[model samples]
Target: MSQFKIRGGKPLKGDIVPQGAKNEALQVICATLLTPEPVTISNLPDIVDVRKLIDLLAALGVKITPHSPNEYTFQADTIDIDYLYTDDFRRRGAALRGSVMIVGPLLARFGKGYIPKPGGDKIGRRRLDTHFDGFIKLGARLRGNPGENFYGVETHSPLQGTYMLLEEASVTGTANILMAAVLARGTTTIYHAACEPYIQQLCRMLNSMGARITGIGSNLLTIEGVTSLHGTTHRCLPDMIEVGSFIGLAAITGSDITIRNAGVPYLGQIPSVFRKLGITLHIIGDDIHIPPHDHYEIDTFMDGSIMTISDAPWPGFTPDLLSIVLVTATQARGSVLIHQKMFESRLFFVDKLIDMGAQIILCDPHRATVIGLDRRQPLRPATMSSPDIRAGVSLLIAALSADGTSIIQNIEQIDRGYQNIEHRLRLLGADIERIP
Candidate 1:
């Protein structure tokens, strides 16, 4: 096991470039399966999840060529359909939740797909029914063997496009259906679809590859199926969640950092949400410049009610950054409510923050009330375990602002998403070391 030993109370200073978006990378990489021509991608994040997906694609016989540190070319000229049944497929497919997305593209290209039970963070009851149901709605037959713990999709005839109203605006579900719909025959209309930038990027990439899709950034989408798709080059946007985390880190640790190539146009409502927490950000060109602040005050409602930060769909606060928001609130001058509506178990990490001397009330599984310390009292350092990716980074931010040294185990969770995180933070003068 690997752990991080961090000494607190040091201000980080420098320009940090945000890595390519991980969520977008997952969707875009899987889109490569939709075409047999070469699909060249740049600005790919070098994270564990992406590496695993690339390995799985190779196992399925996709020709992958590395061009540079953050660029690759993939050509799925021929694929071994039978590889999906091997033990190697089961082990690798179960290692990452993103692996499930491969089924959609495979079903479109080869008329069949299979995957073992997918694994990811145990945040809540993340259901796969949306994906399976969407596939079935598009004329694919679904099969599952519970005794073997495997799921499969097949269709004798070409998928016939039809209208589908998604149960929820599930991100992965939308990506899967969109991939499957591209090769389907006839027209497909999707209502109440996810409008996140990731989805928009996938649509644009597919369109560039000759799939006709309308409604780029809205809930209603119209897709005209194409018999085949070609190849194209795509560069993903910067990781917005990482940008928000850096903003919170600067506020909590009194650091001044500039995040370059932040894709400011795509970061919807994030800067305003952080501004509500009294953090100062200067938008310099395409970068976000966060200055040092010893204290930040949480804004209350206009009627003197407590301020509440909640997550919603895109153009609202991101659920991924609620943990950072909760940690940033710990040092603010007033109290605020952190309401996580999407996932039930994400707020349980507050117990670890409370152990570090923050005043927090776990109202329930979905909400937490935080009373800030106003920087008068410093949080005491303690050893902790990372439960998930976002929580792991939240704990690291807390440790950097605490009184003494802290040890955090299970850092692999953080590495699965963030690339060389400790090394990146070290460039900004943070006192962090990784040990195995």
Candidate 2:
């Protein structure tokens, strides 16, 4: 395994262009299975997760031809459905949560699909019930052994659209059902759907491939099932979560960094959320610029009370950035409540920060109150292990700004999403090294 040895107390300064959204790219690649023609995708992030998904697709006989480093054309015309049932694909498919999306398209096209338990961050109980529920609504019957970590789905006939009020606004669930609904016999109305920018991009890509979808940016989505779909070229959106991560890194490390190609339209509540934690950002055209500051103070309410930052469904503050915000708040001058309402275990990482001289009150599994020291007391660096993708980046930021050298293990978790993170940090003047 490789580790990152970072010497802190350095201000990072440079320009960084964020990679394509890994979340969106996964779903878009799976959408290729819905058609027989070639679907070209551009601006693809050369990350571990994307490469794994592409390998899974190639194993299933999806012809993939690389036109460039970050571009590829995938043709599912010659797919061998049986390849998905093999042990190798099943084991590899479980490596990422995005792989679960293949079940919907596979079932829709081949009348059957099999998948092992999907794997991802161990944040909390990420159930696949919502995904299966969508499939059942689309005329699929699912069955699997209780103790077994596999699922099997078979459809008696072509699916007919039905209205479904999703129990939760699960992003992958929405993507799964959206793909299944595209080939259904009738119109499907999905209430309480996830309307995040990534989901909206999936809908737009599906539309370009001859699927009719309305309510692109809302919780209620109406998908008119089509008999078939063709091929199209799609450019993945710039990753907003990475943008937020970089923003937090620049602030905590006292760096002046500019993030290029950041989608300004999708960063609706992000800047304001950081602003509450005393992080100021400037949007120069399509780029977000974060300048260096010696001391940052958290903003309080008009009633002269502490402010709180939390996550909700789409258009609300993203849950993915809560860890980043919590880490950034450690250097700010006031107290703020960081509530991670979506996951139970996400707040556990704060304990590591507290050990490094941060004043954090772990209210519960879902909430924590952070009192910023305003960079007064230096944090003593220590050995740390990455827990998840977002938390891993947060810890890296903390390590980069700490007083001494620190080692972070399990960097593969960070590589799953962020592309060339060390290289990007180097460009920003961070003294981070990758050690094998």
Candidate 3:
């Protein structure tokens, strides 16, 4: 496995630019199969997951042309559906989580779709029931058993629209069913749908392509089925997860960094949540400026109890950044409780940080209590392994602020979500390099 060798205890300064949103790109790229015309997409992030999805599209005979490094035009005029049954297709499709999205557009236009059981990060139990359940509700017949290696969804006739109350607000599940519903015979109503900004952007793009969708930023979504859709252009927003990671990096490393074109308006509660950690940041136009600090503090609740930071749906702090927050709080002036409600095992990475001298108590699988060191004793670096994307970057942040050189293994997890991370960090005066 590739590892990162980082010399710690040095501040990083300069401007950094986050790439386009990875989640949104996965959704919209699959939407291209809804029409035969060319769909031009710009601001696409070049990461492992995104590349895997694009490769899947190409394998299905979607003609892809690159206009620039971050822009592409896709035309799915002719698709080789038979390829889905091949070994190559099954092996490639199961490599990334986003592969399931292709089923929606295929079933919408071609009346069938097939995929192997998909794979992704091993954070915890991630169920695909939400996805297939929505498809079955839309009058499509499922073609395989629950635990089978390969499954399929097909409809003999055009799908009929109906109302569905999602069990949970799953982003990919909603995107999948929404794509299928747009071509149904009548109106479809979805309650408790995911309303994240990326989902909202997908709705806007669909609307521009002639789909009748209402409730752009709310949980309730209404879609009037259209017979067909046309081509359109879409530019993805900057990744908020990356922005939050950078903010955490600045907080722990005592650095002054300016993040350009951060799309601050869509970053709901992220800035305020960091502010609660006593990290000073200024919003100038669309850029975020975090100044160098000697030390930071954690704010308590209004009743003066220990502040509890948790994750909820949109308009609430994202669970993706909780790892960043937990790592940032290592050297803060006070204590806080981090509740990771959605995923059980995300907080497990704290054991590695504790080895580096952060005072953290794992209350359970879902909660961690952090007592900040207040910079009284700097962390002593040691070798560690990255478990996932967020946790990997969080460890990188800790290593940068620690007193000695540190080694991180299995960084392919980091590259799955981040692009040229070591190169980018080096540009900001960070002492980080990749080693074989």
Candidate 4:
């Protein structure tokens, strides 16, 4: 495992451009498999997960050409359908949760899809029932063996689209179903579908590729099945999670930094959530500039009650940024509740912060109470292991603002989502080194 050695008490400066959206990249890359035409994708982050997915595509005989850094063109003209049943595919696919998305496109175009149980961050139970159920409703046969840890979906007859009201607004499930429905036989209506910016982007891209989709940016979607789809150029939105993380990093380190090309419109409720913690963000065109501050105080409610920040569906605070929010709250003047409604085990990383002298109470698996130090007393650095991707970055932010050198182990988790993070932080004048 890799480790980061960070010397604290340094304020970062200058401009940092957020990378491409990790979640969106996964969906769109899988969408490329829906068509045989060459698809060009720009502004992709060169992170571990994205690279792993690309390698998976290559392993399936998809021809990929590198145009430049952050740009690639993929042609899935001739795929090795047999590769889906191989041990190599199962081993690699199980390591990434995003790999499950491949099943949608493959089942749509090839009439069969197989996946070993997918793996991801150990935060909570993410069920695949929504995905398989959608396929079954669309006339596919499902077979799985829990003992063998394998799941398969196949259709001998052509799929006929039907109305599906999902039990939950699952992001990946929505993407998977949308991909499958685009090539199905008839019109499909999906109610309570996830309408996140990533999903909206996928809808737009699919439409550009000849799929008929309506009601974008809203939960209800109607798709008219198309005979075939062609290639299209897609540039992913700038990563909102990374943009929010940079905001937390600047607030924690008292740095003056500008996040360029931040895609401010897609960052719903995030800037306002951070504002509750007394961090000021100035939006200049498409950039967010954070000025240096001596201290930031958490805002109380209008009724003089303690503030609470919680995650919800789209246009709400994202669960992915709750860790950054929790870390940033450690230096504020007042107290607040950080409620993670989506994932259960994500809040356990607060113990590592408590060891560093932050006042945090882990109320349960899903909620935490934080009492701010108000920057009067700097945090004492401590060695810690990163529990997950978001927690890893939060710990790095904590280490950067601490009073002594800290070593963060298990940084492979961080690399899974972020691209050249240590190098980017170094460019911002942060005192961090990636030690092998």
**Candidate 3 local Cα displacement, residue 292, angstroms:** 0.6
lDDT of 4 by residue, 286-387 (tens): 999999978999999999999999999897789999999999999999999999999999999999999999999999999999999999888889999998
Instruction: Pick out the ten consecutive residues of candidate 2 with the lowest summed lDDT.
Output: 81-90
Q: Return the number of clashes found in candidate 4.
A: 0
| lDDT of candidates 1 onward, in order | 0.93, 0.90, 0.93, 0.94
Q: In angstroms, how far off is 65's CA in candidate 3?
A: 0.5
Residue 418, model 2, lDDT: 88
Output the better candidate (2/3) by lDDT: 3
Query: Candidate 2's residue-wise lDDT over 97-206, tens digit each?
Result: 88999988988888888888989887998988999999998899988875889997889899889999999999999999899999999889999999999999999999
TM-score of 2: 0.98
- The TM-score measured for candidate 4 stands at 0.99
User: Model 3: per-residue lDDT, tens digit, 220-250?
Assistant: 9999999999999999999999999999999
My TM-score estimates for the predictions, one after another, are 0.99, 0.98, 0.99, 0.99
